[model samples]
Target: MEYKIYVQNLKCGGCAKTITNKLNGIKGVSNLNIYVEDSLVILNCTEIILEKVKETLKKAGYPEDGEQNSLSSKAKSYVSCAIGNIG
Candidate 1:
């Protein structure tokens, strides 16, 4: 299965390596792709373990979810508020 995680505060190679090491140790995780620009981590795993994933991400100095990308958040809010408006 493919697992998508939203990550925050990834700034450099060290941050990437840290998260990679923690996740690579997981038995069911086949692959992990981190997209820093969007603060997202795409995981290929047999099992989707959200709690452990969140914990590991926290230990790696990054947190998954509950945070939004600035531009995306603004766009979403705009779209939500614009719904049903008579233009």
Candidate 2:
């Protein structure tokens, strides 16, 4: 199934790239797309892996919308953004 998850701390192409890389690496995820402007991530995966997907997003510092965006999350996002740029 396909899922559309609105996320926070998605600011630019770097964030998008990181999100794309992180999510697409998951075992059950595929055809992932990240919309930086809208803070959206769309992907195809099994229902059973949905929570894992969300957990991965949170760990990458791009927590789903309506979830807490803590200071550490923001900092981790910045780091991820930088790494994304370098990669």
Candidate 3:
């Protein structure tokens, strides 16, 4: 199945690569797409890996598009924090 996730903080191709790699690591995920301009991520995977995808992103320095900032401008900054250490 395909799941559309609101993932903010994808600043550049490097950031997108990080997200893609992390999400693709999940066993249930077949593909991943990130839209930096729209601040969204489309995940192609099974329900079984939904939580895993979130966790992976969390660990990768990008939340599922909603967090402390909650704004497009601050998304990348927050994502950097999340990726840096989550501290």
Candidate 4:
């Protein structure tokens, strides 16, 4: 099954990489794709683990679709972007 989720605070390549790395660690997750411009994440996984995926993303600072981005998250994205550029 495929899951489409829009996340907030996804500002640049670093944010995308962080999200991709975290989600890829989850069981049953496969073919993960991050669309930075759209703040969207696409993944193939079992429906049974959908909530787990969402929870994992939330923990990683990228909340699920419809969740507003907090000030801290915005700041984090900026820092992430800088760090991404440095590496």
Q: Provide the lDDT at 68 for model 2.
A: 97
Question: Per-residue lDDT tens digits of candidate 2, residues 1-87?
Answer: 999999999988888889888878889898888888899898899998989999999999999999999999999899999988889
Candidate 4: residue 49 Cα off by (Å)? 1.5
Clashes of each: 0, 0, 2, 0
Ranking by lDDT: 2, 4, 3, 1
lDDT of 1 by residue, 24-67 (tens): 88777767887767767888765547567776776545655674
- Over the full model, what C-alpha lDDT does candidate 1 score relative to the true structure? 0.63
Ranking by TM-score: 2, 4, 3, 1
* Per-residue lDDT of candidate 3, residues 1-87 (tens digit): 898887656666667766766676777787578887776788777687787887666556566755543454355545554553422
Candidate 3: lDDT over CA atoms? 0.67
Over the full model, what C-alpha lDDT does candidate 4 score relative to the true structure? 0.80
Question: What is the Cα-based lDDT of residue 77 in candidate 2?
Answer: 96
18-65: candidate 4 lDDT, tens digit per residue? 777777888889989999999999999988788898877776677776
RMSD of 1: 13.3
Clashing pairs in 4: none
